[model samples]
Target: MLIDTHIHSDTRGLEDLELMAMCLDGVITLAHDPFEMKNVKVWEAHVEKLLNGEIERAKKVGLNLFVCVGMHPRAIPPEVDEALNKIRDYINHDKVVGIGEIGLEKATKEEREVFIKQLLLAEESKLPAVVHTPRRNKEEITKIILDEISTLNLKNSNIVIEHCNKETVKWALDAGFYAGLTVQPGKLTPLEAVEIIKENKDFANKILLNSDCSSNPSDVLAVPGTVLKMKIEGIGKEIIDKVSQKNALELFNLKV
Candidate 1:
């Protein structure tokens, strides 16, 4: 009963692979970056394909699936209005559960503008967002997301800020936003995620567990790895269940 809160639903070559083999009961798929092509025309085409395509990849993997669609901060091209329109079009889809994988990155003016727009859309749609904090200068970026919520008076519980490490998690938890600890190479390890849970037991109510796997090579088994680590540390079964299953389901309003 594992739910990978952040993974790409469209696995490139793993079409025959099974989510059960990976020990996953479900997945929350964030949108692929549209501007990976780096041209407005190409980006627009990708958005159409992304929003309108059938979810064959998830069906092949045989997992309970949910989706989040928006412009990733790094991929927020010049045609952000067009991108937002696509997000708006799909936000109410039954399979779509959130409005993200968006937030600070490089922290440029363009990134900030797109991020705030997505946040507002999430607010208006009453959907939780899957926010991505930059790998570099993570704390500062996390603070920027928090500051935006304060400035706009957005609800904290409406977003789950991802990739939070020890130093940045407290800010998110203290502010009432969910803290998503991602397990991946060069990020939080299974041991590290458990340690953070141990360190902040009182502030861990909305803690989320995820693998952060995508088309790019990363540990797809990281979510299960964290559960194993938590067990090894004698963490309570209830705590593990909350982080890996219950919290994500509650945050995204998913059931599977």
Candidate 2:
């Protein structure tokens, strides 16, 4: 009953989806809209094609799939607001999990603006949020999000701080929020993720694990691999199950 909370299947081929279908029971693909369309006029349709293709591939494989549509901080264009609103209209379906992959990066004013708008959408829609934190300004962005939750009168429980490294994990834990670790093989290896989890047992109640696999190849089922490694390291199955499955379902309001 494991569910990967933040996989990126945008570039997955048929073979990849089939393999994923066998490996996991459910998946939530967090994808970014076309960022280049800011200059081009026809970006909306292009973005829809990408999202629709992702959903179709997952369904073909018999995996219960869902998606979150938004522009990443790095991907936001000057006219991103228009594109974002267009995306909002299509997000009210059962398969739409949340407004995601959104947040301020490196203290940029533009990213902050886009993040605030997307955050508002998340609040309005009553959807859990998936957020990205910059490596350098991780604490700053985390603090900003927490502060904004109060200013916007948003609840703390509806946000997930994603791609959290060590320091950022602490911030999430301190804030009593869910945290996602992207378990790419060469990038953020499973060993590193296990180490983080091991160190943060104090807040294991709120930790979440994700593959964060885009189209790229790595150790295929990274979430299961992490669970296996944690078990071999003497971590209990209940703890493993909570991080890999239960915590995400509870946070996202999904049935497991």
Candidate 3:
């Protein structure tokens, strides 16, 4: 069974959900910036949709859905504290798995402040964190993320530095964190992802494959499609199973 460790189902269609259910055992939908959000109220409403509306929507297609709520770095408002308070109220929900899709966008001082606070929340709650690495200046931003993480007493195993490419993947793995390879447009393609796996010795244990499906250009079937690519490339089934399913299951503490 495959588990897509990251996706945003809020804007997906029924056809996509059905296709995913046919191929995947489950999915984790993370809270992200609603680009047009003007205030904390919008953030609150957006999260409510994830916690309530999206969960039921996934169930209709027989897809086991999980959630992670956080203020995306791009979406952090002037009143950051208010946004965080809202997250605190829902962080312990039965279906919530982590504090995620949270990290640097512009690497602003305010963004850093907000990012560090959420990291502490994840540490305090003993939950996994799914960190985002921006597409631009990825190396520099990822380094900053790692440095910030180092100051906290959080477990390495509980953090996933997501959207990692060849260079940043090594950084994440070297730092003892799960490295998420997102197979989405403008991210790593299936072949590139497989190439990274082939290059990194014993990397199956520290990798998580995801589509990061959302309103942006994405492939909802990316996790399964990548598995097919790996098979064609003669990657062993054992390793395929670990990256596509087992690693995510263990990291998220998913019972499915």
User: Candidates' lDDT values, in order?
Assistant: 0.78, 0.74, 0.90
lDDT of 2 at 184: 80
Candidate with top lDDT is 3
List the pairs of residues colliding in candidate 2. Answer: none
Candidate 1: residue pairs that collide = none
True lDDT of residue 234, candidate 2: 88
The local lDDT score (0 to 100) that residue 176 gets in candidate 1 is: 83
Off by over 4 Å in 1: 15-22, 34-41, 44-54
Which lDDT tens digits does candidate 3 get at residues 49-139? 9999999988998989999999888877677888888788898799999998899987888888999999988887888999999999999
State the lDDT of candidate 1 residue by residue for 208-232, as single tens digits: 8987776555677788888998999
lDDT-wise, the better of 1 and 3 is 3
In candidate 3 the C-alpha lDDT for residue 230 amounts to 96
Model 1 residue 169 CA deviation (Å) reads 0.5
Worst 10 residues of 3 by lDDT: 149-158
- How high is each candidate's TM-score? 0.91, 0.87, 0.96
* Stretches of model 2 off by over 4 angstroms after superposition: 33-35, 39-43, 135-151, 185-187, 215-217
Tens digits of per-residue lDDT, candidate 2, 1-256, equal 8888887676566677677778777778775543454542455554465468777777787876767767677677567768677767768666777777787676477777778888888877778889876656667777786666557766646788887877778877777677888788544678889999999976777888888776555555888888888988988777888888888777777753
